[model samples]
Target: MLDVKDVTRMFGTKAAVDRVSFTVTGPAFVGIIGRSGAGKSTFLRMMNRLTDATFGQIMVDGTDILALRGAQARAWQSQCAMIFQQFNLVPRMDVASNVLHGILNRRSTMQTMFNLWPRADIIRALEILDRLGIAEQAPKRTEALSGGQQQRVAIARALMQDPKIILADEPIASLDPMNAQIVMDALKKINVEDGRMVIANLHTLDTARRYCDRVIGMRDGRIVFDGTPDQLSTGVARDIYGADASFNESATSTAIPTDATADRVYADAMLS
Candidate 1:
């Protein structure tokens, strides 16, 4: 379980995330949607402690994680893994080593310095890659893989931490439509199969509706809507996106059809 109470982050005088409070139970896929300047990214960062919340209580189970310090704080971070837009892998490094890096916080200084990973860690990394359907890429340099594959490697690295909550900041924003679907599907599978709670910051409304069990829409640093996917109607989306009537909701969708029939439907919609 997770509880974010009155979470707020201020930049000098401006509040990026203001008085945001929400509770997320175990093993659900939650999507945070909004326009460019909404606090979605900042909120995810705060969850992973990549960015500090000016004032808030972030509770996991019954404890306030925000109060942790030193090794304790680092342990909290290890349990709450972050996946970023840029993959964040060492390009020249082999994929297995990159995933093994996730456990550096728990290793001795000399072990990390010499890049010596325990046999158990390496085996677990391979297992995670296998589960994500990228096991074959484990021996290849991360840079040799395609964009979609690299993102999967990043996911494997996150899994290496055995995180209870996975926070993704625009995991698919840089990918093409097809690749976007793949990454989202991977996150969904992690939530369903591995029982990991996932919170992703997404710009595409259609993708959110397809994959998210719950949707939280942010506007100008505040949550404007919080409900299930079905509750997020077109009108509600417009409010979150600040879109006027001229905004065709489909235009905001990043989905691309894989079948011929669906492709025709998408094409016709474009023509119409």
Candidate 2:
């Protein structure tokens, strides 16, 4: 679904993302794991052209994203929805309206002026909310929802775009364990059932191993490891994040119960 070749990004003399390359086939869930300042976020943003690369190319559906401009870039971005660590919803808008914002690219100023989302779009948004199991909260103010619900609302908004690729940057960073599971599960279902490609930058190795089909480890702006979850044992993690990688050992217990509200998270995504 996406191809990144020798992608690099620099800030004057500093290289934030350095010569990273990878391929993402459709219906795959890929995780990027790294410590703080490791450039994982820079790498993901480059895929959407959110940050122009100092060097390298990103190909999505055969078009070189680096070459696109204006409407073309906007069109490409619309096809690649991004979910941030902080659910970036409008605080004053109702949950449903925030989700509908995903299709604003297809709506006009007049339609948007009156919040007149088409019936089909509205229906689709509602369906996405239901799929995420947050349909009952659609009428609530975004700020009134719980952290997990808010993040699911963000996911629903992304789904409203009907995107080909979903980029989640530290998606569960702000959530509690239960909420994290809920958010991660939604992402997993999107990849498995919906067949959309998912690429997420993760801080926790446990989450990466739990949720990703393929794991890519980054350090100081370069990919150090890219392989199946089973391949990321303690030694490999130690190499990527040093001794602290052992901290992830606690997540090994299969006993963690899935909250009823978030059934689809990382539960079955990881290869056993």
Candidate 3:
């Protein structure tokens, strides 16, 4: 569904993303994993046009996304929902209203300014909350929810657009283990049930290996490994994280279950 060819982003002397090339052909869950400064987040941002790439091209379906401007770009971006590590919910807004934010582009300036979403829009937002298992909280202010509930609200908001692609940049980075599992399960359910293309930048290889159909490993801005979780060998993990990678036998022996799914996904990744 998305094609990135030789994508490079540079800021003066520093190169954030370098010659990254990859493709997503259908509704699949894909994970982009790397250590800090590896450019995973920058690459995701480029796809959403949050930051313009210094060079290279990103195509959605068949359209060159970078070529879109103004209204066109906004329209396309609305179809590509972004979930951040920090749930960026408006504190004062009700949960349903926050989710409705996804459709801002479709509203008139006056309608949005006054927060007057159409009745149908409100119904749709409530339905999304129900599907996400947070319907009861819809009338509550965002500030009244817990972190996990807040993130779910963020996902509900993203779904309100009926987005074709979902980009989650470290969605579980701030949560505890149980909450992380809840969030990952929600994402996995969306991918499996709705077949929405989900791409996430994850800090732990465990999550990627567990939930992603394929894992793309990055190092110093280039793709070093890309394949199924089962195809990823110990050697590959070593290469991606060095000998001290957290998923090592000793470090991961006890926490295996929490990361088992990610381990399997990475293990299944192709050797290429």
Candidate 4:
């Protein structure tokens, strides 16, 4: 359960996120769709409390997340995991250790210094890596893996926290279309299987329509549209992107369903 009311963030004379408001109850995959500079990333940052809101409130349950301080703030951030376009893994560290570091918020300094993680935590990290389809890469150095694999590693690290909410900022922007689909599918899988609410800042309309349960369209730092994917019509999308009538929407599609997607659609549909 998350509620954001009139939240705004300003930089000098500029407002990057202006009076954004929404409520998401229960588990659902929500996509914030927009072009560059639409304040999508800033909005997610504010939700994660990595950047403070200049005004208004973000409530998780009944608690005002903006008001939290010290350990409480750190605890809130831990429960709200973030996955970024850049893998953010320690390149020299083994994949398993990088994933295990997700627990750094709660682990003691001595334990981290001595690499004395409990057996159960290590096993849990392996389990998360396995679930993300990167178990084999666990022992390898993080920099050795492909972009998609590394992103999954990032997701595994987030899952290591048993987080309640997952915030993905331009999650697949740096990958090829195929790898992008893999990462998106992995995120969807997590949302479905674990019931963790996923809020992603997505540049591609096709990805949002195909994956998200709800879509929030932003433009010029304000929420212009909020509805189901089906409601994001051509006109609506045009307004969100500030495009002219002849503007080609196809250019915004980064998700071109791989053979994996086709199998899940036409091929797998036959079995049902």
Predicted structure with the largest TM-score when compared to the true one: 4
Clashes of each: 0, 2, 21, 0
The lDDT of model 3 is 0.83
**TM value for model 4:** 0.92
RMSD of 1: 3.3
Write the residue-wise lDDT of candidate 1 on 1-272 in tens digits: 99889999999999999999999987989999887778998988888777888999999999888777788888899999999999999999999999998888889999988999878888999999999889999989999999989999999999999999999998987787888878888999999999999999987666777889999999989999999977766567657865443334434455544422322332344345
Q: Which parts of model 4 have CA positions greater than 4 angstroms off?
A: 244-253, 258-272
Model 2's lDDT to the true fold?
A: 0.82
Q: lDDT per model, in order?
A: 0.84, 0.82, 0.83, 0.85
Per-model TM-score, in order, reads 0.91, 0.89, 0.90, 0.92
lDDT of 1: 0.84
Candidate 3 similarity to native, TM-score: 0.90
**Model 3 Cα lDDT, one tens digit per residue, 53-112:** 988998888998888899999988998999998998898889999999989889999998
**Candidates by lDDT, descending order:** 4, 1, 3, 2
Clashing pairs in 4: none
lDDT of 4 by residue, 120-200 (tens): 999999999888888989899999999989999999999998999999999998888888998999999999998999999
lDDT of 4: 0.85
